[model samples]
Target: MSDQVQRDQTLDISQSFIVQAPAGSGKTELLTQRYLKLLSVSDEPENIMAMTFTNKAVDEMTQRVLSALKSSFKPKPKEPHKQITYELASQVMQRSDEKEWQLLQNPKRLKISTIDGLYSLINNRYPLPSQLVPRQIMAENWARDNAYRYATEQVLLMIDDKQQGRAIADLLLH
Candidate 1:
């Protein structure tokens, strides 16, 4: 089925869903539409959380949803599918345009982001284990830095040993 039909059919359902498709298959558009659907129904975008694999996807989905919401206030597009989605969004936002506008203005409540983004938000909001420190998000390369540090320590250990250290160090360097 086309994305439009699928979107229309699933617009009212509040159940969890997954959109699996190859690249350029409108997966992002489907996600944006579904998010819009949620906005239409609840007017509580903060209550809707969406997780994607990459930062780019998160940004794209966020932008698309915002664009759709903004355009919903303007004249409907000539494209039929666009018209339907935009009108649906218009209807949903009608009662709480100010709140929705505020949501658009501030994205913290939108909750559309990468898995890493979600994790960071949760970690910041909650206390970590006694042994663990709060971590930087993926954008800061925290994991990579830790891995590099561990590897360097291991290499240094091997270099200091006299027995198999040379062989092991040579193997690792090569």
Candidate 2:
């Protein structure tokens, strides 16, 4: 198939997918298209999930999707690629503009987020099997530093004041 044809097929939200691409390579554009496609068929926007590696990416995707939805109401040139995206959005608008507008209002329900955002969502909704006490997650670097400090302390406790062990413990302390 032609690349355009493949892109259209990929954007068809009927299928599940994982798309990996380099930075500045239109991944966000494709993701926005897919999101608009989902909105085309589904009444509940909350059911759809769009995840990215960073919060910045999640925000970008959410904004782009919202922009597309808004554009769907306005008139645009009938360019092939844009027509495809706008067409899906138009269908959603035709079904019930009020419902679509309501869905767009609650972004938290929309489920567009980074991996850490998804983790927080899952933890909020479900109990852990381990039954551990719930706590706010520490920042990654801070947690890593604390882990290193604890490990160093444990190693120091294991070492006696013997010359080699004391030297190793001292090195770890510094």
Candidate 3:
């Protein structure tokens, strides 16, 4: 890609763009740079949201941003990509210091999360009538157990039907 494209993606934060690329195309790096730039310009760290599809991606992105910020305190790295990250992180550190964001000390202020997490955050802030009760993400084991319970309930209900009950009995015997 041309430098202009790179600049547009990372430096031009005025407009949002959907980045679609193959694997290992430095999308995360570009996103981390853009996030740092956004942090420098944003009034509050929470105002800038970076969402990904999965929790793992969210964790990775958050770690990358935080790592970049921590790395800015060290000597400049030799790699070109690391140099870009260092420069952006340095700019963010300066802006953070001026604004008293305390990003390095309180990295949780950065709002990098999964899409589901964003929905949950929004729901927590402005819950719908149907969602009067707060919801929590179900753990894998809980989900599996709940699914089994639901399936058992459905099968028990089916047992009340004569034809289904006969089929179930035959299947069990077979």
Candidate 4:
């Protein structure tokens, strides 16, 4: 596998880059390294925008960036690359442009997010077709509540407990 991403490859400065990483992989490390690299060459400090899919990722990335920045931005130092791994995930995530940062500082931009949140953003950005039925309504909380109530009602309606147990098992498996 390639140890480093090749920068000479094609890039579109105006567009966002999406990197898909498998679970448990070193995605945070790679992202922070790329962010640091982006900062290294940029004349405009606020030009580069990196985002994580969830709040947890944002926290992780922010700490990694700050640690890397602190070490690199300083004068002669001790173990120089201690900040590389983000072992100490202790840093405040702030925007280079204060106004923009302030605008998006909620739990939304703070990083930890549900899949539904991401899908909503995608839908808003690239809307579905004109006549196509609108995307299935996301029962953010209703699905759980409704299914529980319906199942309980069905159990109460059944005469024999043994038959109800089999039906419940079948419903769950299917």
* Candidate closest to the true structure, highest TM-score: 3
Per-residue alpha-carbon lDDT of model 3 for 1-174, expressed as tens digits? 895566556568888787777898888988998998888888888999999999999989999999999999999999987888899899989989999999978988999998899998887876678865445433555788999999988887797688799887676688
Q: For each candidate, what is the lDDT?
A: 0.72, 0.72, 0.85, 0.49
Candidate 1: tens digits of C-alpha lDDT, residues 44-112: 667778888898888888887778767877987998767766876676567347554466566666788
Kindly give the stretch of ten consecutive residues in candidate 2 with the minimal lDDT sum: 131-140
Could you estimate the TM-score for every candidate?
0.63, 0.65, 0.69, 0.36
Clashing pairs in 1: none
Scored against the true structure, residue 84 in model 1 reaches a CA lDDT of 65
Candidate 1 stretches greater than 4 Å from native: 1-5, 98-101, 128-174
Clashing pairs in 2: none
Which scores higher on lDDT, 1 or 3?
A: 3
Better of 2 and 3 by TM-score: 3
What C-alpha lDDT does candidate 3 achieve relative to the native structure? Answer: 0.85
Provide backbone clash counts, one per model. Answer: 0, 0, 0, 4
Ranking by TM-score: 3, 2, 1, 4
Error of 3 at 108 (Å): 1.2
Over 36-70, each residue of candidate 4 has an lDDT whose tens digit, in order, gives 55544454445556654676776676665655544
Give model 4's clash tally.
4
Backbone clash total, candidate 1: 0
